[model samples]
Structures are given as C-alpha cells and as structure tokens.
Target: MIDIFGTLGPKCDNEIMLKEMFLRGMTGIRINLSHVKLFDCKDSIDRIKQAAKEAGTTPKILIDMQGPELRVGDFDGVVSLAKGYYQTLGDEWIPVDEKIIRAMEPGDEILLDDGKILAQVKEVKGTTAEIYVKRSGGLTGKKSIRIVGKEVPMPALTDEDIENLKFASEYGITGIMQPFVRNRDDLLAVRNQLQISGCPDLRIYAKVESMEGVENLENYINDCDEIIIARGDLGNAMPLWELPGVQKRIAKTCREHNKPFMVVTQMLSSMEKSAVPTRAEVSDIYNAVLDGATSVMVTGETAIGEYPHEVIKYLVNTANEADKKIKQNKTGE
Candidate 1:
C-alpha cells in the first residue's frame, strides 16, 4: 500500500491521539524539526513508540530537519507593511537588533516567509541597513526568512539537529527528511554527519523545495534514500502557477529511479478547521496516487487540525478507492 504520512503537532502529540491516527490509517509520523523544540520532539517520539506498541503496528517515524532556515526577528507582535512601502533593515527606519542583523551582509538576497518578498542589502550600518525590495509582497512579523544563493559554510549539523539525530538514533526512527538540499554535496554532508553520529542506517529523504534542488534532483536522489516534494516554500521559490509541472517532474523522476516520493503541503488544507475535505481536495489526492506518488503527507491538517483523525481516515479512504480503480483499469477485471 502507498504510505500515508501524517505530521505530528499540537493535535496529535499525545499518546491517545497518536493511537487514533495510527488506527485510522496513518502509516508514518513526520516530526517537523522546524516547529517544535527538541525536548518536545523527544517526548513526542516516546509517545509515538508507546502508542505504536499499543496499536500493534510499527509506524515509521520521519524526522524532518530544519536546514539553514532563516526567519525575521520577533516583531514584538505583528508588523504589517503595505505594498510598495519601503522598510529599512539597518539603522535608519526601524531599529535593528545587532545579533539578527549581523548575519546579513550587503549584496545578500533575503527572502521573507518562503520568498513572498525578495530583497537585497544595499548598505549596512550598526544593527541596521538599507534594503531594496526586488519583489514585494505582504511582510508580516516573525515570518520565515531565508537567504538566496547563500551556501551555509558551517557544518550541516546544527546543535539542535545533532540533538535530534541523537534522539532518533536511540529511537530507531525510520528516516530523516533533509530540507532544502541544494546538491549532492549537501546530501553527502548530512550523510557524513549521520554516520559520525552513529546513525548510518537512517534513511535520508531529500526535500526538493528550490530551483537548485529541482535542477540537481538526480544527484540528490542518488545520494539519499527518498524524495519529498515540499511545495510550501517551493511554491514561494517559483511561480505558483508552475507548481503543478514541478510536482509532476519530481514525482516522475522519483518513479523512474525507483525512489519513494511524497507530496506535502496543504493536501487537505480544509481539515485545518473542518472535518471534511473539499471535492477538489479529494480529486487532488486521487490524481497524486494515480501519478505513482509513493505517499501523501498531511501537514497542518493533522498537525493542528480540529479533526486530525478524521483527516487521516479521509486520506486513507480516498487513496484506497483510487488505488482500487486504478487496479481495475490495469487488469480489466
């Protein structure tokens, strides 16, 4: 059966909810490294193991790594910037925090919350600088910040990542989803780190979420165990209209190479507040299965959704029905 991966978050962190998710047909649990703290993640892992034992099914655990993530400093609360409004990053318009601003240099491209707006540092002063917005979108407070074309020269193993990996080793999590993999070298770096950390058996799932990753997908797949088409930031990286084609290409590449691939982000977005999925959402999941996607991921739908177990049931039923139809057609039975 094609695996159904559900992300664990506020909704499904406890043992009771996790057991319900598993019984309802979630084959794997994805722990997002980007959101929860390390201690919380370890607790969740323990809960998952205990739940798995009770359910009599060994649910695969996927640890999603936050790789070189960039984010705006805390904005006190929420800062709303109007379109075409100029905001200074350095010492002129808004007061800049020294530590946060120090990481940036002139000529560096900055992306706010998955590249909603693109900016470049033109000049820098003490804890502040002038930035020119090459592309403009709504800039909210505490949104994800990323640097474009910047190779983080530091080791791929961050302190938090190391701690998480150590936990994973002890827990025997099924896989590690490496985010924002730029090339083969990045995969190697992560692999080397894992090996040194004594997790050489952990499967690596490379996340394709950038133009660079897409262009060099073959290399990444060769160096890793599986692929995850993370369309969240990827949609931000490229034109929203182009996501379909990119997703198709990613799925096709993975299939041709016999590598498992997962489609993630907003698969059942309506479930965030509602119990039922939209008609189009059902068809979308059906089409993804028809396209030979190895798995489908429900993020916020199962993470913080009001009906996390219902979402899991819906996806399983939808995919199962789709698979049956596909099989009937293939065999003409």
Candidate 2:
C-alpha cells in the first residue's frame, strides 16, 4: 500500500477530525516541531493516540525535528515585505540566525517562508544586513530561510532537537524525521541520539532539503530508514526549474537502492482553501506513484486546510488508481 502521512495542525488537531482522517486511510501523523516546543505538544499527542485507538489501528507518530534549519525568529502577526525596499535582519526587527546575517554578501539571495518571499543582500554592517526585497510576500514566525547556492555550516542537530529526540524515545513515537539532513554524518548523529535515548530501533527518515543533501542522497538512502523529498526547501536550494528533474533523479536512486521514500509538500495545495483540489494536483499525486514513490504525504492541505478529509479522499483515490495501473502492467491483464 502507498502509506499516507498527514501533518498534524490546527484543523485536524482534535480527536474527531483526526479519527476521520485515520478512517480515510491515513497511516501515520507527522508532528512538526518547528513552531512549537515538544513539551507543549502533550495534548496534541494525546489527541492523536485517542483518535488512533478509536480507529482500531496502531498509527505511526513521526516527529519532524528542526535540525540546523535557519528560520525567521518568533514574532506576532505576519510582516509584509514590499518589493524594491530594504528590510533589516537583526535581533530586534526581524530576528534571524546571526551566522546567516554575517555570511551575507551584497548579491546573495535569501528565500523566506518556503521560497514565497525573495530578497537579496544590499549591504552588510557588522552583525546585520540590509536585505532588498526581490519578491514581496507575507513572512510568519519560524518560517524557513535559505541562501541561494550557499551551504551554511551548521550542527547536525540542535540542542532542542536532541531534547526532542529523547522525549520521543519515551513517548512511543514511531520515527524521527530529521530535516535538512546533509550527509551521512547527519544521520549518524541522529542514530547516536536514538541509541543514547535507548530507542535505537526508531526509524530515521532523512529529509533532503539542501544541495549537500541531494549530492549525498545515496549515503542517506543507505544509512537512514527512508528519504523524504522535501521539495519546499529543496527547491530553494537550487533553481526552481530544476526541481522536477531533481525529484525524478532522487526517486530513481531510491528505487534502485530498494529504499522507501516519500514525496511531500503541496500535494493538494489548492484544497487548503478550496473544497476541491485542482486537476493538476491530482495528476501530481498520480505521477509521483508512477515515478516509484513508496508513499506520498500532504502537509498544509490536511494540517490546516478547509477540506482535510476531501483532500485525503483525492489523494487516496488518485494513488490507488495509479497503484492499480501498475499492477495491471505487471500482470499483463
């Protein structure tokens, strides 16, 4: 079966809605720890457990670790970036990793909020930089930041990530999804933590979200339990036009190595607001299965979308149809 994993969020945060999703064939739930502390997610975890119990299945609880990812720091309501204007990046105004600011050069590009907002460094002054907004969009707290064509040196795991992995070991969580995994050593660090926490058997799903991760994907596939083609930040790591080919190559490599991999992010993005997904979205899901994806995941669509169940209905239907076609081709029916 093509396992389906839905990100837990506000819309499907309760038992009733979660049960509805489970009944519709969702095999697991992904708890993203980017925006909230792991200790604060007790109620959410309880809700997932209760919902899974009522559905009569053992659901996989995967904690998405925020490992060495640079993000816009905490803030209130969204900040609007206007085109052709300068925005300050510092601890006071728009908080970001000082390392990122220090690494900035006049021409370096910065992608914010999953590449939605684009900016370029206009000038650097000591610990901050003046960023010229190239593409204007709303910026939210804890959203991602990426510098084009550059790999910022960061630790394999953050201190918070270590604490969270230890917490997951005690909580019976099924797996740990390590984000921004760049090399074999990244997975090794996670594995070491899992061993220290005494949950060494927990699956380590490496998220390939950087050029380093892509260049070293074979190491990830060989060492980690699975590969997550996190197209959002991965797209930011390279030219947007090259994303499709990159995804295909990753999929092919995973299949050749007999490793499981998932295609995630924006599967049915339109359904986040609309009640129905676009035809192109359906085609995207179908073709992903045809490309030898072991599973497909929906993030914002089910996590905070207007039609979470409807979105899964479309995903399940589309992927199942693709699976059926593959079966027929194999059997000569």
Q: Which candidate's lDDT is highest?
A: 2
Off by over 4 Å in 1: 73-86, 90-111, 115-127, 130-143, 147-155
TM-score of 2: 0.97
TM-score: model 1 vs. ground truth: 0.84
lDDT, candidate 2, at 92: 83
Model 2 local distance difference test score: 0.88
Where does model 2 exceed 4 Å of error?
A: none
Model 1 lDDT on a 0 to 1 scale: 0.79
By summed lDDT, which 10 consecutive residues of candidate 1 come out lowest?
Answer: 90-99
lDDT string, candidate 2, 1-333, tens digits: 898888899999999999988888888989989977678888889889889899887889999988989887889998899998999988688988888888789999999998899999988888788899999999988898888887788898888887777677667789988989988888888888889878899998889998888888887678898899999899887778999999999999999998989999889999999998889999999999988887899999888898888887888889999999899999999
